[model samples]
Target: MPKDQLLRLQALEAAERRMKIWTIPLQTPNNRGAFLRRFIERVSDRNLHTAVPAQNQSAVQKAAQFYQSCSLVYTTGGERELSTVRRLLADFGVFWPRLSNASNLLRICFAMSAVLDWAPVILFSLARPGHIVVTPAPFYAFLLGRRRAMLSSSNDGREYKSYFSHMVDTFRRQEPSSDVLSYYELLAMESQIVPALQQAYTAADGGIIKNGTLDDILNLAGEAIPRSKWDDELGKNFKSAIPNDTTALRFVIENVFFFAEFFALMDNLSESQLAYYVGWTAVQGLSLFTKPAVINFYYPSRSQALQGHVMACGALSHHYMGLAFYANYIREEFSAHELADVIALVNHVRKFFREGFSSSGALKEFIDKSQQSLDQNAPFPSAASAPLSFVTDSQEGQLNELFRHFPDQKPSIFDNIQSVAVARRMTRADTRAANFRWNGKVRLYYLTDDKRFELLPTALEPPFYSAEAPPAVKYGALGAEIGDAMAALVSMWLRDADENTRAKVYTEALCRHNRPVIPVETATTQVPSWPNISRRELAERVVSLNAAFRAFLDATDGGNQYRLDGYESLTGKRMFFIIWCMAQCGASYGKQKCHDPLRLFRYFARAFECKVGSVMSTIRECT
Candidate 1:
């Protein structure tokens, strides 16, 4: 090789090393845990060089201390602290032993308390603006273990029952109580609930129950519980008085079956039995904050020494203190210049979609309809601002207030976690709610109601994006992401169009061809048959990839100007497609093999000069 090529190879190696520093460790399960631990430690480090506002410093410190306390409690907490937690449960009338004295209302209160502590135990959970969403209970799913296996027909429920029994035995040992239900009875109750939960979890998106009001939900739930009880519990949860007329409050019921099954079970089971089940679920929720033995019980074969502690603590912190972690992360990792570049790139992509759709005679009507919706929706205040911005001062102030209630003197991990939960519950009724939703994730999402996009801070980091990368590479990765979001918005608009308009657009943009079959081994029962890509999905992928490719060409003067250091053998166009394919590599299992959009892009064929009638070129059916 020439000296110039060798020098380029050296540069590529250094870049790969830096990328591996973040990406390679995530390939294996154990290394993934260690990576997360290191990440949390860096986020929690007090000596961060970034300048956080003095007012926000206390909030960041409290958030860090909260994670530290959870780690310490998980590793070193003893029976005394565990006993206090048990007493705390008793105070809420959540007794382990079957206590006949606990009333139906008391059981409801216990479940509500658990919800306030961010460990909801009910089928329907509270959402923003006082909405209640009927969905699967994640707490129950955690107890079942292996969600996919538990939901499969082959699962006999024996493994989950055994796991439940072990959990009960572990908790029972912490505080011995008499008259507790036999593990068999508990398993039977769970069996009845699991089927309904599974139904909700597996319900098809098209089968979504339309949005209704609280009154509609109560009617669907039947007369199992009186309306007064619901009104009282909901009012308490929302921290406001629910009016006699609750038709104004929205209820997003995704699955009606789950609510029906849940209420029927509630009506039939005895009060004492309900209390025992609810208490058990609550105790399991607090298992993370309990002794090492309780925490380790869930890990089983996995090493519990350092990796487990970090993983558990890191997960719990993210779940409970997401906003604080996000604030700290952006302060330390993200730069203003990178944010500006991303914002400009996203705006460019948006402009491309706008102009392309408006100019196309076939899509003109669709764009007109979408433009009307956008004007009417008048984007949410947060969405109206730049898509890629940091957490606001108001958001940080609310976070500080959330942590202010926790005692400075080291409180038990349970106490600290519960305090944060209570604070969140208290502020749920406020008009200016904290904008912590999806701020910590590494993805871009489109808000349909707001007609805007929001890109989280983490998506700007390595593997997905880098400020130093050439325009072609950046467009290949983040540009494609932006295009995908825009495509989704187009699909949403198309879905709302009149039947004639949709049919016309589909007839023009989508053409069906016989999909080739891929052979699978007979023994692989775990793999389900892959469905043919829908016309809408194919259309979206085409629109996304084409828009991204066009944007790249426009940005780099028809893809002739930009080049990667070691990839000089390839043109910018080829590098663009290659990096787009490489970005999704190893992101999922078996998905890329079956559902990769690249195989359907005609541009992919043209970029690499594939022969006619080949798999890549044959995608002309869709194009």
Candidate 2:
């Protein structure tokens, strides 16, 4: 290797070592799964060793039993579970190898109903007050490889096809019929369908047909699915929610072209082939709960090896029994002091934004308006105050209540999954009524419709925010996160503003910096090329970071008392930047792009007092 290449490799190795020190927080095993594991252990201890009051124990014990059953099914996948799956499919009028000579429309409805809760085989509909939005399901990408990209990599396609073929053969061995289709034929069909689905989904306008009617859908679908059959299926599924007497009902096809192409393809296939395809979809949906042989066919050993049974089961439980798991987890793990501190930090960051934008010249009016919108819509109820009042609580509770009707011990995991799906369908109306969605992951997000910010409860835990941490650490980690959210809000305003106003804000906020000259190989070591952050994005990042740093100084009273003990040479301001860098380090490991914002603002350089025109001081062209 060349001398320059050797140097670059050494620099990359050194950078990796430095990053590991900062990424300590992210190294915790199954951080998100901790709550579930604790709850499960507590429930087990109560059941085996001690007696808890009956009334208090019901919900938690039921949740524990349900989770255990799901875990057992997932870990000990066998023929019994596969037989249970076949029976459940038969319940939905789906028989493998040969389906009854039902009309295509009826067969489609039956197939859709079978996996309605588990997967949307082709398309799924979401009902609104006077309209419904129908779109292609996400399951296609899971079953077939993301063909647009994977198909280009012939090696990946071949491997995926081989895995898929093995999966088909595994299922075929269980059936006595000789009519099972060859996997190659199925792959060819999938290749044609996947790209068309992708194209329809990603089209410029999304192939949306606004304010359409059932007749309009039939027209788009042509003879593939008739109007009468479609209407009957809709009425059966929706019941009184959509009245037969009303003609005011509207439909929105999220991708009309997908339906046109999908129905056309269905029309081309014989009943036997269509039956086989629909059966394959059902298998794909249940594969997770089937025998380990089938489950591991698609998931490689490396991926499976990363998580143990407890963590894996917890993850699956979270997905299938989300509301019960989330409510229980929040009730068990939420901390009031931590939430209060986070709320205070968020408020401080908001104040920083308000002050900064008030004097931002051309951008002031637009930002103020956006901020006003946020203020008018109050923040979501803090999980600490009301654990069950998150945006989706009521609806989730109603759906969760359905599981209470099931027997204490389900015979099979597939049965439990089917029960959950049935419950979901029963409460589909509540889903349609909901206008806001809530995700409890460890992140902050803006709800556009609600015009308010939500901080997931998990984000208030250690390394992100803790009541015991020093003011500098709190501001460095959580305060910087709040700053990012606020900056995104400003970015949204800029996106919607007139071209002239946007140009003015960009010009006013721009920070010009000199680029440091380095060996090209060393410069590109972390990434193939520098991340392409737009001018507007760079400006927002600068403003947000400076605001956060200013807020930190205010909160700490411009004192240096919060310095780290081990790093006695580092000043308070330097420690603040270090903690902030550490908080973001996990996402940016091996990539220099994450450092661009700080480097552009020269805060890192200023904090460390790096020499002017040095690489740390002058790198990056602009902010």
Candidate 3:
């Protein structure tokens, strides 16, 4: 009787006429009326439903009345009738919960169901026969469902609307596709995923819904596509008639091989695998907090400053996962078969990283170079033989190009700090210092300063020094010792938390670097002829001056901002930036040849909480 309910019904009717999507009889009679009358008399609020007159009617009319009334109910409280009412309403083609209240996952299921239901028509309309949708969830879902007959279908052998219907009917019914992540499963996993992965499983198992099964489901999802099925076929697609140097053919085969093997390795039962997966997932999730995904900013323009930060976090996650795989391979004692697979994956990633460091626009350069590199017959490089390949000239060039864009006037640390700064949340200076370690020019910002944490001179110049230079030598010795201490602290903290804890402990620890450290030599500088700038006075000036000259030092220090902005807002963007910066710093400092590997590893690992290891949750900080 009310204008809105009538309009909704009219709209559904009109949609049926134009789209011919579905139809439902518009009436129901007395048995439903008794249920409705009984339900309505109990409601204290009269305006809850459109004014459906309580009267004697046909079964279809009464059913329609009941459906409309049930649809209007927002949520199920303690009422026992609500379940029965919802089931009946669903049968009448009112499947959605209230439009505003529907979860995002539900919307996805609905849309996917529509697509699956209409797949035959869709296929006919398309000119291309092999087109695939690129959305992460839908693609994953389609693969998940079709790979296994998880749900019955009607639209051709491929349609899947019924699954969606089942998914939404209740929460527990939304299970992982015996093949991709389902909404219900994602929700279940997310609710229980602690930093401590094992504990998370225990917690989930203890709950009404089963937990800790995400890994099993995720692992099983990949198993649906077996290596035997795709191996020879993928190889034959790229085999050239050429004998020795078929670079193009080799690249394709190798990548396909790498992806498949790596996918399997990701499912391994090794301790490293557990740590790596949990940490990687944590990094991905943490990105949401620092970036917020709300603001619309261009990547190289307004958002350039944040780009490295984001990439740093993302890359670190990848790097750690890669390391975990490496460590697991090492732990297993490197048999020939395992080594072959490990080498292939390492080459794939190294190939990817090398392409980045190669040229002006590395991404563009990579697309062209990769095609060429893949054709070659040479075996892909390993950690031992492929140092040049992994951290290649091209990636270095790209990093330099990226770092050059940060304005070169002086050594200021916070040029783009404003993007992350929120009210009362000025970026703690330590964030900038932490971020600098990841900017790829570690020696420039750190080496010349004696690792003393003092602010840089307002007048620093370019091409500070090579790793082979005298200053770097000094840094290698002393910085290594300090770095060791840092790592020990991080390893212990990470091991102790439940699997679900955010890696925030690492973030908080790195902030300590913001407070400048005093060298023992400077403890008693007594310059009687000159006013002594107390160490505290010196540190304050360093922080303030870095903030002051952020725009000028873009070249010497790369485009990193030394100023204290965006520290408070702590958006996902900043989190990504900070975490990434830390990763770069770790990789740079932790490189095998640079300093004492054990010491350097412990130092940055502590700072980063060794978030990259496999099941070795905590690598001791070299204290």
**Most lDDT-accurate candidate:** 1
**What's model 2's TM-score?**
0.67
lDDT of 3 at 156: 38
Between 1 and 2, whose lDDT is larger? Answer: 1
lDDT (tens digit, per residue) of candidate 2 on 1-623: 99999999997676555434434543443232344335444433332232224243343444455566655654577898777666665655555444335525444543454344443345444343445656555445344432333345656567556666775565554546645555567776566555665566444334568788867877787775556776666666555456683355687765676667766766666555555566667666566566666666654463552233344455445445544544454554555665555666776776776676566677666556657655532442454332113423523355446345433435455556556555544443433211111111123343344344455544555566667566666777777777766666676667667888887776555544323444223432232233256667666666677668878878878735433434567676876776676666434231242465666655677677664445444453343
Clashing pairs in 2: none
Give the per-residue lDDT of model 1 (tens digit) for 1-623. 99999999998887665444433313433222233335555655532233333233466665666677776775579887678767666556666645445546434443444444444345444444455555434455444444344335665655445556666675564555676677667767766665665555444331345578767877777786688777665665554423445656676665566555556666777656655666677676666567877665555334743455665565556555655655667665666576667777776665565555454566655544544544432332332355654445325666667556444413357777666655544455322122322212123344435564456554565445787676666787788777767667666677667878776665544443345423222223232332245656666655667677888888888898534444456787876776666555543222442244555565676778754344444434442
Model 3 regions lying over 4 Å from their true place: 1-184, 190-225, 236-623
In terms of TM-score, the best-performing candidate is 1
Candidate 3, run of 10 with poorest lDDT: 118-127
Q: Please give the range of 10 consecutive residues that has the lowest summed lDDT in model 2.
A: 433-442
User: How close is each model in CA RMSD to the real structure?
Assistant: 7.0, 10.0, 29.0
lDDT of every predicted structure (CA atoms): 0.56, 0.55, 0.25
Model 2: lDDT to the true structure = 0.55
